[model samples]
Structures are given as structure tokens and as C-alpha cells.
Target: MKSLIVNADDLGRSAGIDAGIARAHREGIVTSATLMTNGPGAEGGGAVARENPDLGVGVHLVLTYGRPLSDPATVPSLVEPDGGFPVKASAVIGRGRVRTDEVLREYRAQLERARELIGREPTHVDTHHWVQEEPGVFTAFLELARESGLAARPLNDAERERLRAAGVRTPDRYVREFQHPRAIDVAALLALLELIAAAGDGATELMCHPGEPDPELERTSAYAVARPVELATLTDPAVRAKVRELGFQPITYGDL
Candidate 1:
């Protein structure tokens, strides 16, 4: 049997985003979401998660956006001189000085903050901006998942292999093409689903960033304009029907 986890990322970034994610889960096929514990809408996101108990929520670990939950003085290597994280993963990786200890400290803080806000432990862990994929930080990311016993999102085959080797829970495959602006339509989404169906057995995760447009999101995210389109496609009745037609079992990371 084939299973799919449609995980919306960047939750808690803004009220508009939180609204979109909640709508997608309530009215669409979104089975899970990853929360940005330090974001502007974090508290609101928590409220929504509580309201929708079946929506598995997870920590969207951060190192490349916003301020750190840990004190800047404590995780200095993960922050700039201004005490905020850099805007891009490249900046974090290029520094080559991101201490694993610092990654663990900040990630742990984020995880704890998520638990406090959501009123429960998160279902899993994944990175914002795919920051956990950075070689310098990947080890720390794995260590956190191993210690927490939380499932994780592995972006590639190699990461999946490593996660399995470490005895951490993760899906067998990861698919991110649906978020591509050009592919945010129903036809594209259906086609992508078809591909996953053919990839055979095990679980697959489709990373998505569906949200409503707001000034804050527009200002902070380069991919903001495409969000509503993604939201529309995700919640479209046809896409939902297609998912069922293809015999894909929708599940949460916790189910893995």
C-alpha cells in the first residue's frame, strides 16, 4: 500500500499563513504541518492546531530566518552580529562555523517552544529553508531527531538512508515539485500524484507552502505570490478526488 503525507511548511509565519494552513487541512487534504515556533503567528497557529486535533503538527526548525529562541549570546555562531539569523541557507552554510552544539541548543529551544504553544509534543521535525540539509548542520539535526524520537523529513535519498541508519522514523520518499510555481495548478498536482503512485509502496511526503497573501508574507518571502495558487490547488475538490482515486492513503508523520 502507498501512503502520502502532505505537509504544509512555514506555519506560524503570519496570521494569513496560519489561516491558509488551517483551511487546507479542514477543507483540503493537508494531513500535517510544521510550525515555526518563533514566527509572528505562532500563538495563533497553536490555537488552530488545538482546534484541529487530527492535524499533526511538527517543529519547523529554523536557522536561516527570524530571531533565535535561544539567546544570541548563547548561539552566536548561528546568528549574525545583529543577533538575528541570516535570510538564506547559503549564509549559514558558507560560514562553516555553525557549531553542532549551537544547532542543538537552538533546535531544542524551538522544539520546546513548539510544545508549549501547541500544548503537546510536535509530531515530527523539519527545517525551514531546508537548513537541516546543510552538511555542517545535518549531524545535529539527526541527533535531535534521534534524541527526541520524533519523525523527520529527509529531503533526499541520502538523507533517508542516514535517518534509517540512525533508527529515526522518516518516509521512504520526499516530493517537493508540487510547490513549484509553474506546477501549482490542479493538472500539475494530479500529474505529480500520479508519479508518486507509480513510485511504488512505502510512504512519500510532499512538501508544500500554501498560504494567503499578506504584506508580511510578501515582504518576507520571495515565494509569496505563488502561495494562494498553491492553496487553491490543494483545496480544490478535483485534487482531493484525485488523491482518493489513486488509492493513496493520506497519513501524518506520527503515523509512520
Candidate 2:
């Protein structure tokens, strides 16, 4: 049977987002979520995790958004004057502003924060903006995952191969939708589901960012409007039923 893991990213970005992730896990098709260690709603996300033990939680290791868990002095190249990371992933990777050792240290700090807040080690790890795709960065991240005995999200074929070479496991396939803000078309999401169903065997991960709109999200994220639409798509009865109709088994990151 084909397995699917609906992993929601950015669990602790805001209270609204945290609530949406909780609803998606409890009432919809979401099987897992990735928590932001330094997110504004981290406390709420921790509460949600405690309440819903069945919902597998991973660390959404951030490198391009919000504040870093590490000291700004130590990672001067990775932080802005405001103490948060640059919004663009290229600013860090393309410019060679971030050091590999600094990245490793910051990632470990974020993992530690996640463990403290979520009350356990994260089941897996994923980057905030696909920053792990950068050459040296992914290797360091893979090392961290291996040391922690946790899985990491493989965003593409190359990343999958890299993970395989390192003896790390990920879902057999990964699916995600990239869209402009407020343009989360449900029809497109459904089409993605159909495409994944028609593909080869083994487990696949469907990544989504779903949430309710609120002041915090509006202020912090440019993708705010798209969040609610994504939430609706995930919780839609039709979509949930379609997964069953396609004979897909919903699993979590841990299950990979």
C-alpha cells in the first residue's frame, strides 16, 4: 500500500498557525508537523504537542526566518541587525555569509530548544527555506541528523540520494506546492495528490503550510493569505476521502 505523510511546516510561527496545525491533525489529513523552536507561538505549539501525543512533531530547523537560537555574536554572518536571519536563503548560501561550523552549531541549538519546548527530541528535521540544499550546508545537516538519530526531509532526488548514501531514511517521495501569496489553489493541491498516487511505490510526503489568518502571521509572513486556503484544502472532507479512495495510508515522519 502507498503511504502518505501530510507534514505541516511552521507549527509555532503563530498562535493561529499552531491552532490550525492542531485542527488539521485532529480533524483532517495532517499526520505530522515541524515546530519552529524560536517561533513566537512556540509555547502554544508545545502545549499542542503535549495534548496530541499521536501527532508526530519534528523540528523545522530555521536558517532564513525569525530569530536564531544561537548567539548573534557567534553567527554574525547569518544574522541581521534585528537578530533574525535574512529573508532570502541565497543571502546566506550564495554569498557564503554563513559558515558550516556556525550552521552546525546553530542547528544544534535549535534542536535543543525544540527538545526543551516540545518535551522530547524531534522525530525528524527539515529546513525552513530549503536552505539545506546548499552544498556544504546539507552535509553538515546530515551529520547532525545522524548524530541525533533523526531523519531529515529530502526535498528532491539529489537530497534523497545524499540521504541514502549517508544511511539515513526519508519518505520514498516528497510533494509540495509552491505558489504566490493568497494563491493556494485547492484544485492544484488535489492534482498533486493524484500525481503522487499515480507515481511509483513506497511512502510519500505531502508538505503544506496551513494556518488561520491573524495579526502575528500578517506581520511576520508574506505568505499569510495562502495559509488558510491550505488549511481548508487539508481539512476538506473531499480531499480526505480521496486519500482513502486512492488507498493511501497516512503515516508520520517517524514512520518513514
Candidate 3:
């Protein structure tokens, strides 16, 4: 049997985003989402998660785009001179200044923050900007998942092998192209469903960023305009019907 987990990322980035995620899950095929615990809308996002108990909420761990939950001083290698994270993942991964210990500490803090706000353990863990794919960071990320006994997102087959070898749970495949603006349409989504159906057995994760764009999102995110388009496509009844037609068992990360 084939299984699919449609996980929307960046849930706590803004109120617009939180609203979009809620709608996507409630009226669409989004079975899971990853929360940006440090984002401005985190508290509201947590409320949404609680209200929708079936929505699997996970930690969208950050090494970029916000201040660290751990004191900046303690995670100096992970932050900039101004105590905020670099705006891009490259700034953190390419600098070679990141400390594995610091990454572990800061990630733990974020996970704890999510637990506190959501009033329960997150269903899984994934990264913002895929930062955890970096070599040094991957070690710490894998360690955290193992320790926390949480499912994780693996960007590729190698990462999947590593996570499995480390006794971490993860989907068998990951699909990331669905979030692009050009692909945020019902036809594209239906095509994606067909592709997943053809891939045969094993669970697959389709990563998406669906949200209602707001002024804050417009200012902070370059991909803001594509959000509502994704939201609309994701919430379309046709997409949900296609999943059922293709015999793709919809699942959440917690079910991995």
C-alpha cells in the first residue's frame, strides 16, 4: 500500500500563515504541519494545533531567520553579531563556524518551546530551509531525533538511510517541488498525486508552504505571494479526491 503525508511548513510564521494552515488541514489534505516555534505567530499556531487535535504538529527547527531560543551568547556560533540568525541558510552552513554542541542545545530549546506552547510533544521534527542537511548540522539533527524519539524529514535517499540507521523514523521518500509557484495549482497537484501513486509502495512526504499572505509575510518572505495559491490548491476538494482515487493512504508524520 502507498502512504502519503502532506505536510505544510512554516505554520507559525504569521497569523495569515496560521490561518492558512488551519484551513488546509480542516478542509484539505494537509495532515501535518511543522511549527516555527520562534516565529511571531507561534502562540496562535499552537492554539490552532490544539483545536485540531488530529493535525500532526512538528517542530520546524531553525538555524536561520530568527533569534535563538537559547541565549545568543551561549550559541554564538549559530548567531550573528546582532544576536539574530542569518537571513539565509548559506550564511550559517557555509561559514563553517557552527558548533555541533550549540546546534544541539539551541534545537533542544526550540523543541521545548514548541512543547510548552502546544501543550504536548510535537509529532515530529524538520528544518527550516533544510539547514539540517549540512554535514555538521546533520549530525546534531540526527542525534536530536534519536534522543527525542521523534520522526524526521530526510531530504534524500542517503539521509533516509542515515536516519534509519540511527533508529530514527522518517518517510521513505520526500517530494519538495510541489511548493514552487509554478506548481501550486490543482493540475500540478493532481500530477503529483499520480507520480506518488506510480512510485509504488512506501510512505512519501510532500512538503508544501500554504498560507494566507499578510503584510508581515510579504515583508519577510520572498515566496509570500505563492502562499495563498498553494492554500487554494491544497484546500481544493479535487486534490483530496485524487488522493483517494490513486489509493494513497493519507498519513501524518506521527504515523511513520
User: What's each prediction's clash count?
Assistant: 0, 0, 0
Over the stretch 104-193, how does candidate 3's per-residue lDDT look in tens digits?
Answer: 999999999999888888989999999976788988999999999999999999999999999999999999989764578999999988
**Pairs in steric clash, model 1:** none
* Clash-forming residue pairs, model 3: none
- What lDDT does each candidate get? 0.90, 0.83, 0.90
The stretch of ten residues in a row with the least summed lDDT in candidate 3 is 88-97
| lDDT tens digits, residue span 1-256, model 1 | 9999999998888887888899999999899999998867789889978988999999999998889999899998889999999888888765677999999999999999999999988999999888876786889999999999999999898998998899999999998888764678989999999999999998999988888877777886788888888999999999999999999999999999
What lDDT score goes with residue 178 in model 1? Answer: 82
Task: For model 2, name the residue pairs that clash.
Answer: none
Candidate 2 residue-wise lDDT, 1-32, digit = tens: 79999999998888888888998888889899
Q: What is the TM-score of each candidate against the true structure?
A: 0.97, 0.94, 0.98
TM-score of the candidate numbered 2?
0.94
lDDT of candidate 2 at residue 153, scale 0 to 100: 89
The residue-level lDDT of candidate 1 at 68 comes to 94
Ranked candidates (lDDT, high to low)? 3, 1, 2
